[model samples]
Target: MSGSHVRLEPLTMDHAAGLLEAGADPGIWAWLSSRQPVELGEAEAIVKAALTDPDRRAWAQIDLASGRFAGTTSYYQIVAKHRILSIGHTWIGAGFQRTALNTEAKFLLLRNAFESWGAQRVAWETDARNLRSQRAIERLGALREGLLRAHRIRPDGTSRDTVLYSMTDAEWPGARARLLARLG
Candidate 1:
């Protein structure tokens, strides 16, 4: 998926170095499931896991201005027969945060899921404590459904509550328009 500010390409081992560099800021990994990758080997391991995951379709977000890997995102927990999927596992480099890159990347992914895949619903979940992520999802026009308490264990070994959001096919048109307007 290509956008003015960012392009989404299938992630590969070749992106490990760029991923490591872009992910140099420790703050970016705070809300993420994995620890920060400190070396090329660790970044490669991260890439390999994404590629090998059976239920995930991962992509490397390439910043158009610099033509470098900015971060990664994925479509996971896909259920083809039900036409449902969740978008998460996203992290943008510190430099790319608060830029048009995230909006365009999400717009492309949501478009593909709803239009191309004929999906009935697209869902998102984030750590309940991550207000920034919650706000970002709301800005994308996803309706907050409810919260799941103790949904998962954090990397620090603490129970994490998850905030859930969703956009159905019925809601896609409005959401799409909103996203486009933001991109403009």
Candidate 2:
């Protein structure tokens, strides 16, 4: 998926070096389920795990201007029969945060899920402690459903409360408009 500021490409081991450089800051991995990759080998392992995950279709987010890997995102827990999917495990470099990159990236993913795949519902889950992520999700026009207590274990081995959000097919039009306006 191509956007003005970002392009989504199927992730591969070739992206390991770029991913490691872009995600150099340990802070970006704080709320993620996985630990920060401290070396090239670790980053390659991360990419390998993503590729082998049966339920996930991962992408390498590329910054168009620099033509470098910015981060990664994915559609996981997909249920084709129910037309449902979750978008998460997304992280962009600090340099790209608070910019059009994230908005456009999300717009592309949501568009593909709802329009191309006929997804009935799209979902997101974030660590409740990560207020920034929660706010970002709200900015995408997803409605907060509820909290899932002790939903998953954090990378640091502590239990985390997950804040759940979703957007339905019926609500996509409005969210789509909102995202476009933000991009413009």
Candidate 3:
């Protein structure tokens, strides 16, 4: 999906190289869902796994101005019957962070979920220690539901505390407005 600052294309093998190059920073993978891939091959493996996941719809985040691969994000844990899904496993390269790329990308994703898919809710979760992510989600107008202690095992083998947030269909209108303002 295209946005002012970025375009999200379906995640594919073609994106693997771009992702590996964009995410070369060692610090980028610190709090991400999976461990840092130490090399291009490992990064390719991560892309392969995302591609293989049955429940996930993954996308490659591309910066529009430079046509650079920014990162990856996904709509996963989809329960179509329940009209619920999650937007997570998102990570942008160092150069793209703090830019409008993320805000626009999220706007596109949320719009697709709530409007196109008729989703009732879109959930988001991040490591409790990730203040940046929490602030970003909050800026999107998603309500902080609660924390899920020991929600899952981190790539480093430690149990991770997750901060849960969600934006129901009822909340989407206001969120959409805020996003539009940001994009302007």
Candidate 4:
């Protein structure tokens, strides 16, 4: 579960404090999947429950430079047989944005998926209106697969069109090189 610039460490009771600290981000929550929790107590429950889910792989994001907990990212919709996976539920404090933190985190995940897990395709989906996220995923060299119209109920309980992006094993070499260049 460890990434290059961050570690996707297994979530545990001991991680409550770090989870709370990471979730303290208020600015980024507006466009994220769920709202940021208000207190350390609330984050603990959320992180704990997210980890207990059988279908998803969740982890804490650790910022290498500050040695501080940054946030959480997970691989959902993992179809091992099909070699497909999705990275979502990701959030980072303003301080960690545009840094090597996210690039390396993604590198690790992609590396593990394509090389370690033998996954053929890695997917990243976001609200179509979230231009920032769309750019970031594209920056990682994912192809603009298409948009899912009214794909899911948003945090505000409204339907949302999801932009789907993906990188396949055939594309991993270029994608990894791009991510590495940024991190370097």
Candidate 1 lDDT tens digits, 1-184: 8989999999989999999999999999999988999989999999999999999999999999999889999999999999999999999999999999999999999999999999999999999999999999999999999999999999989999999999999999999998999899
TM-score of each: 0.99, 0.99, 0.98, 0.93
User: What would the per-residue lDDT of candidate 4 be over residues 1-184, giving only the tens digit for each residue?
Assistant: 5555777776676777877776676777877766677877777778777878787888778887677888778899998789899998888877788877887888888998899999999999999999999998988899899999989997789999999999999999988887777877
The Cα local distance difference test for each model comes to 0.96, 0.95, 0.93, 0.83
The ten-residue window of minimal lDDT in model 4 covers 1-10
- Write model 2 residue lDDT over 89-126, tens digit each, in one string: 99999898888998899999999999999999999999
Indicate the worst ten consecutive residues by lDDT in candidate 2: 150-159
Which candidate do you rate higher for lDDT, 2 or 4? 2
lDDT of candidate 3 over 33-79, digit per residue (tens): 77777678888899999999998999999999999899999999999
Per-candidate Cα RMSD to the true structure, in Å, reads 0.6, 0.6, 0.8, 1.6
Each candidate's clash count: 0, 0, 0, 0
TM-score of 3: 0.98
